[model samples]
Target: MAEKKFESDAKRNERLYVLYYIFGAMFIILLGALAYRQIFMYGYYHKKGMLQTQRRIIQPGARGDIYDRNGRLIVGNRPVFDAVVYFNDARFDFRKEYARLNKLRKQNKEPFDYSKLAIAARTNVLQSYIDEINSILKTDFVLDADFNRHFSGRQLMPLPLVKNLSISQHAILAEKLRVDNSAVQIYTDTYRYYPYADRAAHAVGYIRPEIEQVDPDIPGDDLRTFSFLGKIGKSGVEKAFEDRLAGETGAEIWVVDHNGFTFEKIESKPPRKGGSMQVSLDMELQGAIEDAFPNRKGAAVALDVKTGEILAMVSRPSYDPNTFFPTMTHAIYNDIRDRGAWLNRATQGLYPPGSTFKIITALAGIKSGVIGPDTVSYCDGYYQVGSRKFPCHNRYGHGEVNLQQAIEKSCNVFFYEHGQKMGIDSIAKTAKEMGLDSPTGIELHEESTRLTIVPTPEFKRKQGSGWSKGDTANVSIGQGDLRQTPLQMACFAASLARGETRTKPSILHDTTRKTDMKYHGAKKLDIPKSGYDAVIEGMVNAVERGTCRRAAIDGVKIAAKSGTAQVMVKGRKLTLAWMIAFAPVENPEIAAAVIVEGEEPGDASGGATAGPIMREMFAEYFKGRQVAQ
Candidate 1:
């Protein structure tokens, strides 16, 4: 009995010893694994933790206001609400998800268009949140094709799910998203507004969203957020003065939770607004000019003859720039662009000066010793250059005429004889001297330069042709590729008024105390004073009793010239009527140029079509000055 009990006790002791050894071995192995992980994988885990907790974002600043000369707010910002979603916060892996969707499409035997497949993958990933938003906001929204492009191109920026949200929709989204909204957010954005619509749109310019365009002027380190809301000027004064008008970007560091939700702000920097730009445009006068030529296709330019400052410039068939905001539709953009509504005719539209170029021709003839104030040319109604006979405006002939009488009557035969004698190079040299052949150095984009026909020997060679006497004859009458913008013609009229050439045409007032801010006064021309006096007398006589008699305003002495340019359109001859004038001729203060595209050849006469427009505009401009005096 003793031996049996001892055997049972020994067996039980052995079993307990085995269980202890097994447990001891397992504990040692666990400890070894724990130490290995702590030492070797420290960096990987630390980096992963940091990524989930900290975020740096950029805060975009507001752009500056734009004002007209009268302190009128031509352009400003209006607050709008936009719904945005962050790709990083959503943890969306575009490549992996795209692969998965591609596999499914292959299994389903569907066509493999990579673009469509990509869009499908994006739609699948964003569907859940979109559904939730639709339910909460009581709307039916679809992520369209633009979503694919925007996501692929600018995934670094927040994806705008909905733009310019309504008040009710915004309130509903905010209420529903308060607790579980880490990936989605509603933010305030700005929309540029032009208070006066299309008035002076060409001069004021337009703004567009900063999608993928990186400005060389902006520092890379400044913008930390991919979804920063920024805008840039596309043309006109906005683009020319971009440096002074674009705001600085700022940054903020935030501490976030594991779900990538911002819990608290770690550090922040406020953004700085851009500087305001003050221009020399007058909205009131702009409106008047636009209203005066409703439904007419042409351009007009008015300037301060004393300072060379452009006051009111108008191009007909202008469009409202507001239509380009948020997102422009294909149809709207096509309609505006295809119809040439975006063109700034005052500075970009080129046309022959017609009789207008005679002013320059007369000046050139006088300076080149080809003709003088007393150098008489007989016009038996026609002048022969080769076998072709160029007839004067008066087919019956002025019989014999001098430079002053020739300009007043716009006699083509008189210019033909002198222009042939002076030659193309001489005339071109003098035209360039008066700011005709080159750009006016305006601060606008798309300024058409070198389009005017200087018609020199070099120019003829460049055109793969030779200079001819017939070419010289056509050029003398302001025909055969003699093109000039209305703005340039306005400058010419101003120069004629001042008896000198001035290259300064500014939209900014000279308030800056810097040396560069000084007004560019007129440069005295090298022509004889007799020639200047003779031209001025002819211009005044033109407005008072000659061809431009319609431009004569009551109680105001006006010096003026009229032009009727001919062109062939659709195999038929057409005309463009033009008039240039300055008021109070003795001490001229304002100069203007107007061009009207006549529907018919005979329908367009400089004195009949364009002269009345200048007359009315001049009247409206000086409406109160005479009364007040």
Candidate 2:
């Protein structure tokens, strides 16, 4: 019996030992798991927690202001007021409404989608706020169609309830509403403003709303972000200087609660305004030139003779850029498009240079040794090129006329005779050398080289036709396939005034800018002094007592040329009246070009239409100079 009791005691001791080993192994496993979670998995959980609690908001800076050369505001920002609702401020109301709706649904025994119920509740709550706002402000306010989408995706940002409030309306709302702690607050934003309305509209350009991603400088990129819409350039100089004009982006990092509602602002950075710019446009001159357009469809450009600065650029049938801000409707856009107002005519309109191109023809004749100051040609109403006779503007000719007399009288027969003698290649060479074959390198994206044409023998061959003497004669008179923009013609005039082969136009204002820079591989016009003298004398005489007489200002000695070219538009023949000129034969100041599209074939002529406009431009320019002096 004693031996059996001792064996039982030993078995009991063995069981106790097994129990101790199991408890020790379990304690070790628990300690190991604690260390792993506390050290190795800490960063992962911390990041996940951060993502749920933090949110980022991005705001765009105000775009830079654009000014004229005389410090006049061309394009600037105007403060716009908006009534907006912050979703976070209405979170409690949202929850309360959701609970009430869910209870009602349960009592009715109707199946429900949680998302749909939530959306309906939010909409109802928001409608109540809108109703209150409407009652207080006496304005009709409605919820946007994208309310549900905004609630789902961009709850952190304020939703605009009413936008672009007038001064009185904004004042009334600010005085009536409790803005400090209310869900609905007055938000001040900026929209582009045109102080002069449609003046310099094309040069100033327009902007459209664009939503961009958060910049790299902003923090918490991995967190859910809300961005405000920013403006981007749509055309003109705005598009050309987009990078320089765009403002720096600002950011705010907020600590959000479990429901994605901002509770605390951790960091904030105010946006910086974009860089300001002063363009070369002179608004006073621009206005005068725009008002001088004879019709609704035409273009005019004026440049500083020495600097090639674009003083005035006018494309008629222009729009009020202010109408595009805040928002643009389909109707307004369609109207603008239908009226053909969207095109920048100064740089984009391609037309035959007309008789204005005679300047180049005369220069080419002189340069090619075919004609000189003493060269004389007789005109008997028409000139025969092969079997075809091209009629001059005067059915009765000026008899025998010298080079200067031919220009003064605008005798087409003289250019026709001399042009054929110089050949088409010489005229084309002179035209291209004058920068007529390419864009002027202005700070506008609308200017294109492809649209400009300086036709040649090879060019005609490519079009499946051979060059003809008739074509050359037509080209000599600035007809045929020779196409150029008003801007190009203005640049040519400016370059000629400076005695240079090319003029590189600029829209920026820089007093230190040089005009001696080579443009388009063009060199100085190396024609004889006598050649220039004859052309200038003829141009001056034309403005004083000849076809361009209307362009002459009282005390200003102007060198001018007038042109009337025929074109077939939509199977109807129309005339384009043209005038190109430079002022003060002694010291050139401004050079200009004007083109007017005629309603009928014979209704428009260079002197009758474009010459008067040129006179007005010169009048305005000298008037301003006198005031300054």
On lDDT, the leading prediction is: 2
Task: State the C-alpha lDDT per candidate.
Answer: 0.79, 0.88
Candidate 2 residue lDDT tens string, 532-628:
8999999999998999998988878899999999999888899999999998778899999999988876888898899989999999999845421
Question: Model 1: per-residue lDDT, tens digit, 343-445?
Answer: 8889888999899999888888888878777878898899998898887888899878888898888888889999999888888888888888887877777
Worst 10 residues of 1 by lDDT: 513-522
For candidate 2, the C-alpha RMSD (Å) to the true structure equals 2.5
The TM-score between candidate 2 and the true structure equals 0.94
Would you estimate the TM-scores of all the predictions?
0.78, 0.94
> Residue 315 in candidate 2 has what lDDT?
88
Which runs of model 1 end up more than 4 angstroms from their true locations?
1-54, 83-162, 166-186, 212-224, 255-264, 511-522, 627-629
lDDT of 1 at 556: 84
Displacement of the residue 199 alpha carbon in candidate 1, Å:
1.7
Q: Superposing all C-alpha atoms, what RMSD in Å does each candidate have to the true structure?
A: 8.8, 2.5
User: lDDT of candidate 1 vs native?
Assistant: 0.79
